[model samples]
Structures are given as C-alpha cells and as structure tokens.
Target: MSDPAGRLNIQLRRTPHGFACDIGSTRPVAASGLFCGRSPAETASLLPLLYSICAKAQASACVGALERACGMDSDPEARRLRQVQVAAETVREHLWRILLDWPVLSGEEPDRQAMIGAQSLVKRIFGAADPNGVLLSPGCEKPTSFRSVLEEAASTLADLMAERVLGLAPDAWMERVETIDAFDDWCRSVETPAARLLVGLRDSGDGRLGHTEASPLPDLDDGTLAAELRGTDAATFVARPCWGGAPRETTPLTRHADSALVSALVADQGRGILARLGAQILETVSLLRAIRTGELDGDSTAPSDAVLPAGVGLGRAEAARGLLVHLAEVDRGRVVEYRILAPTEWNFHPDGVLASALATLPDAEETILRRRVQLLVMAIDPCVAFDLVIP
Candidate 1:
C-alpha cells in the first residue's frame, strides 16, 4: 500500500558505472481500494475528494468507468465539455511550470502575478464552458452556450503565453523551432524565463543530461488493459507497471513524441532534458489552440470505456501528465472491486523512466549532481514531491 500523501525517496549510491538509483514511493497506490463496497454513484462522488491533484482527470476516469460498467451509452456533449476542462487544466499545469518553476531554475523570481491572472482566466473560461459541473455525473448533460466566452479566453491565454512565456506567438514559435539548430537559436535569442532556462542548460553543457532509452508507452485497447488490471497480482502491477516486461514512459514527451519540434529535438538530444522540456511547451501550444477550436490535435479518441463482462468495465482519460485509467467491477449497482492505474505509477516506478535517467548521471560534485537530478525530475513533472538522497 503506497502512502496517499507520501513522496518519492530517491537514493543514489555511487556505482562503477556512475550511480545506482533506487526510487521508492510512499504514495497510496491502493487508494482505489476505498471504492470497494460503495455504490457506483457513491464511488463517483468520492473520487474528487480522494484525489485532489488532477481532480478533473480523476473524476473523468471514475465517471467513465462506472458508466461503462452500468452499460450506459456515451454522452457526446458531456464528453466534449470534459475535454474542454481537461484541455484548460493542461494549459494551466504547463503554464504553472513555465511561469513559476522555470524562472527559479534560471535564478530568477517566479512571476506570481502572472500565475494568478492565468488561473483566473482558466476558471472564467473553462468554468463558463461547463457551468453545470456535470463531469462527475454519468450520462448527465446540461449544455450552456458559452462559445464567445471560451473563444475570448482562449485568445487571451494565447496572447498571455506569447507575451510572458514564449516571447512570440505560439504559431510563430512552432513554425520557427522545427530543427535542433533553430531551437538553440531561439533559446539564445529569446528574452523569456523559459528560454533563459534552456540557454542556461546549454551554456553549462548540461543540455543532454539524463538522456535515456525508455520508449514511450504505446496505445493499448481497453480490453488488454482491463485484463492486466484483473490479474492476480493487480496490486503489484499497478504499483510498478511494465508492458511486455519493460517499463515505459507516459509523460508529455511521450504524448508529443511525433510533433515536428519534439521529434527533431529527441532525434538530436536522445530524449534528454531539453527534449522533455520542449514537449511540454509544444503541448501547451496545441492545447491552447484546442481550447479555441474545440478540437485537440491527434486526440481523436474520446474517453474510452470497455465492459469486459457483465458489470465490469475499464475507463481511460488522456490527462495533463499522461493517461489516467480506472477499472470497476460492480455487482447489484455496488462496487465489488475498483482499481486505478495513474500515470504516476508508470513514470515514477522504481525502475521506470525517472530511474533510468537518474542512473545515467556521472559522478560529480554533490551540488551539480543534485541540480541535474532536480532538472530531470521537473522535466518529467511528477505528481508528488521527491526527496533526493546522494550518498
């Protein structure tokens, strides 16, 4: 059982190859066990309370799983609104890192005022798009026409990102930064916190730090995922998931691996710190555009739900961090078994992507090693705090 409020403990001991990293999590991996014995509806209501970090994604997965288990038909409008909320939340999460965290990496103060404005805009626009709060209710729909509100907010957000973060319009930035050399030029020329952080890493010769060979997780049908969750060692599987006996990554880099900018960076940098950071920036641009147009690029699949058998189902949502999944087994309208396989389990597993990158760090001064590890960790963006131990 992982601790619900627990953090990751990363212990790096010197090894002949450089370092041997052991990652341990106290996060409550079994928190879904709380859903057992509750009615499906009750479980849906309880999800938001239990998981507060990505509340919308958590609730979306729970509602979809319960709806599928009950054999309910999909609600298109509900799905659209949920996507909008998720998209806005994604932009917010990425901007938080850009506006607040990136500056600290460059020895600058975080722009608190900008973050406050960003959050306010998010609440106004996405909140207007889904005023009924129906995300938690299965098969429920109360549509409100807020197109103008959404479009205006999207435009404002785009402008804000251009002014405060990108140092250029999102479209212009994407168009210009297609090659590795172009990326370097932009980092050196742009006068923004995000750009400065990248330039700092490059100037310090740490741009390719933490390069790893972990492949991005591939798409799996709901049936295959349900079977894996239904296995005898489901608990172990959720805590430290592996596909075909190997750990895979499910972060922004994985989600945007095929995008022009990200692909070019990864091709040259080998999925290192710079490539990972590039993916997040690229995704934010895509998400902001989606908010305006009501369409996410390459996000064709709606929240997926598959009824494995009578009263058993699996649900999936493409969350900000990665994929969020929930499985439910109900009998007589009450939950018999419930499981959640969060992206955290995949990206932060003991031998997962973070571990692979940490293992590659060459022995150096304690401060240098610690900073490199922190950058890699931040690039991946774990849901929990990490405690680093270098001994």
Candidate 2:
C-alpha cells in the first residue's frame, strides 16, 4: 500500500494563561486534480487506491459523482452493497482507534491480536461482497452466499464491539446512553481494555481537556458547494474550506448533531474529549445495528441521467470521520476538473476545531501538556500521520 501523502505538524507555545498552538499540515492538498481528464469509470477505479484510508467511502463518492455527471441512476443492489462495505470499513476504523490508539493514552500495550482480528473481519466482508476487489464497479454479481457472509461478518464485529469496546452487549450498552452517569461509571470500572483507556483519560483530566466552542453543523447544499468550487479559486477552496468565511467542523458529532445520545452528551459535557469519544462509540453501535438488519441504505445528491449539466457535478458521503465531498466537471465523457474536500481539512483548519481545542489547553509541564494534546488530536482522528512539536 502507498504511504499516506502527507503529515500534520503541530507546534505549541506556552502563553501566560495557557498554551497557543500553530497547526500546519504538509499533507498533499488537492491531489484529486490528478483525476482530471480520466473517464468517470477510470476515476472511480483509481480513487480507492489514492485514498486508501477511507477507500470505500472515496470510491462511493467518486462513483456517486460520476453517476451524477452522466445522469445515471444508481443500481439499487450496487448501492446496498456499497453501504455494507462502507459500514464494515467504518467499524474496522473505529475498532483500530479503540484497540490501538486508545491504549497509548492509557499507557497500555495495544491488543495487537484484537486489531488483527478486526482487520480480518473487514477483509472477509470485502472478499465476500466484491471477490474481484473492484471497489467501484457497480452491479458486480455477488456469490449466492453473499448475504450469509455479511451476516457472519456483522456477528463477528458485534462480538468484538461488545467484548473489547463496550464491555456490554451492543444493545445493552446503547441503552445506557439514557443515563450518562451509569455509562461513565461503566467506562471507569469495566475490566475491558477499552474501558481501561477511558478510565485513564478521566484520571488524567481529559474529561475537561481540549474544551472549546463546537463549530456549527455543516449545511452546505449542492448548489452552494458547486458555486464555491466553480467560483472560488480551485486552489483556495481545496487548501482552506470555510463556510460563511469561518472554519466549521464536520465530525461524527456534527454529522449526527441531533442524535439523541450525541445531543445528550453535548448538553451534559459540551464538545470536549468525552463528548467526541461518546459520539464515535454511539455511531459505531448504530452502524453495527444497521449493518446486521440490512438497513444500510441512502441516496446521494448525484444526478441520475445521461444528459447532465456541463457544469460541476457534486457528490457527498459521510465518511468514517465526517462528510467527504467530491466535485467533478465532465465534458464529452471525460473529466475536465476534480476536487475533494476531506474532513481533515475542515477539522484541522488553522483556525478550526483542532486549533480551538489546542488553545484551551491549561498551562502545565511541557511533557504533560503534549500528552494531553496528543490525546485530543487522536480524538479528532485525522486520516494522516501527525507530530507534536513543543518549543
């Protein structure tokens, strides 16, 4: 697999009252321009390779955009298959974070075996759904036993979530959301490795760490997004995505802003480390339920027809992190322009969510502050590698 394109460099300076952070990303910006001039099919085929972190989501968005550009209706079976793949990927990604990164915050060795199991589960789903591994090709025939494969995959994932992450059955854990104190108590007292990490965060004062104002939920419509892509300089829009002249957040919390559990957490704790973590866990459980019940289905903004407008075609999908938007302009069946707005660009904007959180870090020894900052960044979960610089 190709190494990720770029890295996040965070610099911290001690201020009188607290600390100030200057975050910079060397992550390759606007790399989607490479897709220009390719056929929509070709673009969809290559997108997964280029963005392997969220390959399924990228492929979904690419296919959605190209379909819109060509004005073709999505094949229902294909759409359902894609949703299953996306859900599997999302569950796997969240498990990786919980099994691997969460341990780091708690000073525990990562459960490498469990991480490997999670990886294998995702592979099993993909292997069964798209045996040829053509992630973007629509209407590919599935084996007659494909539904059984999905059921097994979902069952395995549910077991992992219950045993490692939640310390309760998925349904039981979800019910605890109605009582935050009971849930918090479980997080602090449960014997599971994941709960141990949460306990560590609480003991280390992360419950209040990285507190800041939550950005308004993203509400950009297709017309607004297309106008911005076509009107603003392409380089500017890709490098710095802003809504109404200000950086906005599009995390799972923002994407599910009205979710009962998410709303309750935000109302109780604001948007701190705890709230962000809660949103992720809640989303994971919800996705698991949807996957098992075959309720994973949704429509995109991509137009459906062969006769599409010559202007930009916009497609958006909620990735494991947040909203991922893709824009393409096709002329005579060839891509003339392409751009992507990833969730990282929104949350890690210089004056954006991550920055706001960093600015709120309380003054402390450099080492302690750096550790706390790292945990906060992990909560945001950028797709690229990052380093923390204290000077």
Candidate 3:
C-alpha cells in the first residue's frame, strides 16, 4: 500500500422517531484508506453523494466485523433492530423507486416533500438520540418529537404511492421522471437504500446469532469467509525485498497497518497474521467511526476480498449499497493493471460471478437484454438503473 488513510471506521446511531433508520457506509464517502490519496476530511465530504439515504449499511458492516470478531450473533432486540433496519432500507428504496417511476407512470408531479421526508426519517431511524438522553439523544430532549418524524415519513410514502396511482406528481411541486418497468422487476429492484444493516441484523451467517438448524444460513468462519470472498486464488504472495518500502499498491487497510509500522510488520518479517489481524482490528475501528458519523449502517457488509491480483486482481467491498470491487495486476512489483469490478458490475455481469468464471468470457450484448439486465443488476441489490432500451 502506498499511503493509507491513517485511521477510519463507521459508527451507528438510533434517532428517536419511534423506529426511523438509515443504513450506509463508505460509498463515495471518505475514499479513505487506500483507494485514493484524498484526505479523510476530503473523502468525508463526498459521502453524501454515495448514500444520502440510510448509511446503516456501512455501520452494519462494521458491526458485522465486530460480531465476527467477538462471535456474537444477536439478541432479541438486536435481531429486531436488524429486521427493522431492513424494513427501513426497503422503505427508503421504495421511497425513491416510487418517485423515480412516477414520470413514466404518468406525466406526474414529484413529491419532493415525501422524498425529503424519507431523508429525515433516515436520520431518525439510523441515528441515535443525543447521548445523555438528557437531551443529546432522541427521546431525552428535543425541539422536535419522534412522532413528527414518523408521521412525516408515512405521509411522504402515502403521497408518493398516491402520485403513482393517480399518475400525478405531488406539489405545489416540481416534475419528476417515472421509470416504467414490469411489476415483478420493480418489486425486487426497489428496496431500502442502505441494506447491509438489515443483512447483518438478519441471519446473514456471521456465526453469531441464530446459526440454528432452522436458520437459513450456514456457519462461516470470518477468517475463512473473508478469504473465500477474495477467491481461493487471491492469496498469491509477492516477496518485497525492500521490506519497509511501500507496497507498489496496497489496500487502505494495509496502508493503515504500514503507517503504524509497529503494527504492520514484525522486525523479523514473520508477523504475518499478527500484522493482518492488527489491520483487521483497525478496520473495525474505522467502521465504527463511519457508523457514528452516519457514514454507514447495519445494512452494509465489510468487503473482505479484493481481486487486485498478481496478473490482475479484483477487490470486492460490500459497501452500504452493495459490493464495490477493485481489480489490479502488479508486474514485478510495478503496477501492470488496475480496474474496478464494482458491486454493480458483479451483479450486472451476464452470468453471476461464479458462473462468469465458469463460462470463460461474458456476452455483454446478451446480458444487455432488458429482463436479463434487470436480474443481473438486482442480484447485488444495485442502486443504479439498467436502462436497457433497444436502440
């Protein structure tokens, strides 16, 4: 890693609007760590664009890391929180989905209020009331009440649905475009903005809560799981004779370790897991910071695999929205190739990731067919659209 962002983490909050929520983490936010040379503050400023909805995803990823580290599944309240987290994410997604579809549904008016209301609810649900409850947290003391937040969010959802049915936009308002797609496609495609929180909250097999026989997931060792995500082939090692020199290219997590040289490598050069584990430990911290700062939520999962390969590599990070991948290749300690396989790309690939590998190459045009494109995109719960119009 060249220069890693010194330190970083996502945190979480529960705003007191009864049960409001947000779930996101590291999208365009704090392009910290190793992706860019940008400063944390600089990266911090860009977070809003990547996910203005619920940053619960990022927070969730961190929490997942915590759970994985400590080996705790979840308690009743935690489980409920996870479910609600997903629900809130669904609401957030639908919030935009309904709004986005309005234009095509009809030359309708846009319900910007409802849209904005969803935004606020994201804070309420995903945010924690002031700490002291004395005033800082939600219920403790407020110029506002939780009811208003929920009321507003509900009203917005109602208004948005009404607009869809009537094919009219809500406002003394502005006009917005509607995305017309088949009913089924729309149903699955539209969902909470930040969903990793829900994934973590639910039984996504982190080995903590509910790995029961009835539970739908299998037990996955976090270490093995993280490695699996990188693909079995990703462990190819390169010996750096320079020892202390910067890795031609490294992960933010790696750089974080190196900068804290004491923590990165051993004086004897055999620190291996110790150093990696140390970096992993730091990743959890950065995740917490992201959560507290509203950079993420319970909906997102930490990216464990990067495909930045020797010949070429792919780095896959499960961001608040979905998996964001990076691919690279280093030739004799020099950079040979670098590419990104964003979550969307993997999701939108013709065959799924595993399948694509099986098929040898991809059929981009065939994959571009409307339904196919939609399915592929939805696979990763993609936030972007697949405008597969026949040209």
TM-score leader: 1
Instruction: Return the top candidate by lDDT.
Output: 1
Q: Estimate each model's TM-score.
A: 0.95, 0.92, 0.35
* Candidate 1 structure quality by residue, lDDT tens digits, 120-210: 8888776777776665687665566488898898889899999898888987888898888989898888798899998887777687888
Any runs in candidate 1 off by more than 4 Å, and if so which?
1-4, 297-307
lDDT of 3 by residue, 1-391 (tens): 4212121111112233221112222223223123233322222233333434333433323233323222233332342243234335545654453344322222345556666766575556433321222221111112222434433544454354434322322321111211112211322333421122212222322112111111111222334434433443332211110112211212222234344432323232222222222233233233322322334332323323432223332222334333333333334333332223233323222322212211222223533333222322222234443222322
Alpha carbon deviation, residue 281, candidate 3 (Å): 39
RMSD of 2: 2.7
Task: Rank the candidate models, highest lDDT first.
Answer: 1, 2, 3
Candidate 3: residue 346 Cα off by (Å): 4.6
What is the TM-score of candidate 3? 0.35
Identify the superior model by lDDT, candidate 1 or candidate 2.
Answer: 1
- Candidate 2, 242: how far from true, in Å? 0.5
Question: In order, what is each prediction's RMSD in angstroms?
Answer: 2.1, 2.7, 20.2
